[model samples]
Target: MTRSQTTLAADAELTGVAFFTGGDVRVRFRPAPAGTGVLFVRTDLPGEPSVPATIEYALELHRRTGVRRGEAEVQLTEHVLAALAGLRIDNCRVEIDGPELPGLDGSALGFAEALRSTGVRELDAPRKTLRVHRWVRAADGDAEIVARPAEGHGPAAAGLRLEYHLDCGPERPVPPQNFRCEITPERFLEEIAPARTFITADEIPALRAAGYGERVDAADLLVFEPDGTVRGNAPRFPNEPARHKLLDMIGDLALLGCDLHAAVASRKGGHALNRDLCRTLRAAATRGDAPITEAIGVSTDPAAA
Candidate 1:
């Protein structure tokens, strides 16, 4: 089956305080033509410079994913990207009046909900897809991500599947956790999008000293205390940290600018490792070393059941 490219049918907007800057930010999602991909336009800046949300523009930020186009930069983009990618929105123009996206609820649920309300429109163009044909891996100490070809055919075998293993060490607040899921709009919204970003209680002071998350409170996100308890919130899932890891991977992998068909596993991975996997897969696909498929459409299998 062929899959057509998709974009928002109408405009959608969200507003909140940025996680890093602690300033008000408004993001507007506008529909774009097929093949346009995702572009972030700095509406607040002079001339409104735009940055393509592709691996080529990806920047290694502290504990977050970012992209830059010369002097124009957007920080903490993973949640928004994850929302768009999870919904399979192929083309969009994301206009924002701030350097960073709003950190609403520290999850992608808000963005996903807003985009869903706008509905999606299919385009005349076919969707671009990349299928992993060989093993590819990226590692940083104990943190790593690996991708390999999917087995079988049809939609179920041609979509991305992710598994995450999170272990913050025996002395850390967050305990060992695991999560696995095949990427789908429904599953993403319910199982992954609501998983909020979290931090260890001890890391707060250093983050503050580095001028980040000043306006953020425990209620705005998850902060695990040393006693292995959330400071001011409850876990949406028993293994929400692992699910959030998968959420971050979905966003970081979206930088590929195409649908991915692979079985990817991560162990204690973060933005840096996720981006590294994207870079590796992208390089392989660009070199014609990996199998490239187009418009495989949605999966029809009940593997996620």
Candidate 2:
């Protein structure tokens, strides 16, 4: 059966420290009307400037995703976007009191839990989905992504599926890791949401030198040593780094402003490459270049069920 659009049932709030700024931030998720799309409002700004959470507004990939509108910008938006998309939330008003989102536990779990507690309310409108009818690929050096037609099964019939692979190299510590799964709200929370973002022990100095991560401690995130041992925190999943990559990918894709129906295979790809793919897909859809398939593995007729 086709799914209806969704938003939060009630307003929810979260507060923590910004990873880069070390400043306190308060974020609120308010339920938006049908078709409103995800939005970020800077409540701290003079005019309370708002920006749509779309790839078109995505700026430079300086370690994270930043969405901008004129002079207003929001940094590190991927985690919150991932939670909204993972839960199949279609519309939301994300109000933040700072330039960047709080880096709560270095994972999307905090946002997910808050949103879950508020509950999801289905809208009257049927969800809009973008189907991939042709193979499309984008790359940046060795990192790459290939999107193909989905094999409509379970969640893939309504949304998308992802197969992600991450290789951190031999010298850096963490070994090669990969994961493949059909994307869904249930699967995301259990398999991907809990996976925290990670950094190598060696990268600490450079990160500090660059003026970032001042508020986050080694224990607050997954930190691996050159000897392949975790520094302070434990991993939520065996291949937690790879799963976090998948989480980031989902957040980046949410900028498409609709549910996606494709099988995306990614290898060592980061924010820049994912942004490029999103732009390419939007262009192809605009030009009517890629063919459209209504459903893949399941019957499209709601009555068929």
Candidate 3:
């Protein structure tokens, strides 16, 4: 739902020992003036150039998602992105000295807890929203994501319906997985954010060879084992994979450059659909386009449910 701009309370400044999963790293976030959006500055980079979390700067989405500006980029950014979007904490500087955000417990709890402990303050400034005026949609293959403003702010939600047609590996025991939930920050911390990320049994050899999650052991990520082969870490829920997909979708969609104001449902989607939809809408917006005025997946009979 669309919270009034005043509901944000105020701009905030957050500071604490930065942890990169392995342990505490050095970093901090100070509130920028309203409209600054979220910016990441890598102190570890030469002269510490900054990266703005905008669709124009999105680099790629593969085994995981990363945002970049030319050769300089950040990897596996979904966790932090999830935390920011879920918490509704807008406008802060993410200063770090690494290529990846600390994957604390494969969840957003660390970031949430740290920010909570630091406490939030009210800044004497106003917030801005990139309100949708018309509809724009995009798709890749069979997966799709769409956005349309409701008559009014009803509920703030980021949802997904992901279907894995095949298991990730020979040892994989899990069948097709899926789930639907409202996108609320409170729901995130208590019900969703704590869920650990998982990889399939079949992906292990390749992920390791690719130099991703190299420091992690099997336990750190869910590796499914069927029979003698191992599966992902034990799932907190029966359909943990799809839930994590929802988490990643919410995280990725946060880059849309605005706090959402409608119910968004995604079907069998991933970072590919997530980023594609944003780029499409953003381009339309650059040309003064608006949200889709025409109907799409919705039906003409509104009362039928």
Candidate 4:
């Protein structure tokens, strides 16, 4: 059975400090028409410039995902994107009053809960889905991500599967962990949304020196200590780090702007590598190099694809 596109039924709001800018920000999630995908409107800007949440507009930010259109940009977008994708929300207008999104709990749970409360409304159009026909891979040193076709061609097989292998190295503060799950709303909310972003304790000083995370504290996110313990927080799961990596991959892949029917495996992959994989997929779709199927229409333009 084909699924219809969906959007929020009513407006929802979230407010908190941005991890990077350390400034208070407010974001409003509003319903959008079918095919709108996810668009971020910078309400604080003069014209309230909007940026489509697609690979075409993605920015290569450090440790986070962002998108830009001319002078307007939205930073720290992974959590929001992950929430929307995990819930299968296809169209949304995310209006924000700041440059960065709220860093609530350093996880997607806040956004997921708000969106769930707002309710999801199905649109009239059939949802677009990209079924990968060939393997696509991206790598950087030891870190890598690979996307490939799922087995069979039935509706049951037309879902996403993700596996992450987070090898922090034996000497690192965090231990190696692995997580694999089929992407679904219930699974995402229960197993993935609450996993908080984490960093090594030693990376804090350099982040501070780079003028980031000024207002963030150990309570905001998981800070792994040298002795393989979290500072001021308990692990949500024994493999919470790997789960968070999977969450990040979900958000980054949302830039593809369609339902992805593929199994993706990531080993120590980060935002840059994830974005690269999206670019590769987008290019393939544009060139008709991949045997992709669409429920409605797929953009062929290089800028839109």
Best by lDDT: 4
**lDDT per residue as tens, model 2, 191-281:** 9999888999888999999888887898678999888889887788899999999999999998877778888999999888889888887
TM-score on alpha carbons, each prediction: 0.94, 0.93, 0.77, 0.97
Cα-lDDT of candidate 3:
0.58
- Model 1, C-alpha of 292: deviation from truth (Å): 9.5
Report the backbone clash tally of model 4.
Answer: 0
Write the residue-wise lDDT of candidate 3 on 1-305 in tens digits: 22322113333333222223243345565555555566777888787877777666776767557778654576666777777777766666777777666665666666666655544544454443344445545566666666655444323222222222223334456566556666665777776677667655666787667655555666555566555334535667666666677778777777765654444556666788778876665555555444432212211221211
Q: Compared to the true structure, candidate 1 yields what TM-score? A: 0.94
Candidate 1 residue 233 Cα shift, in angstroms, is 1.3
When sorted by lDDT, best at the front, the candidate numbers are: 4, 1, 2, 3
Candidate 1 displacement at residue 284 in angstroms: 0.9
lDDT against the true structure, each candidate? 0.88, 0.85, 0.58, 0.91
lDDT of 4: 0.91
TM-score head-to-head 2 vs 4, winner: 4
Give the TM-score comparing model 2 with the true structure, all chains together.
Answer: 0.93
User: 87-121, model 4: which lDDT tens digit per residue?
Assistant: 99999999999999999999999999999999999
As for candidate 4, its clashing pairs are none
Could you tell me the lDDT of residue 292 within candidate 1?
Answer: 39
Evaluation by TM-score, superior candidate among 3 and 4 = 4
Candidate that would win on TM-score: 4
Rank ordering of all candidates by TM-score, starting from the highest = 4, 1, 2, 3
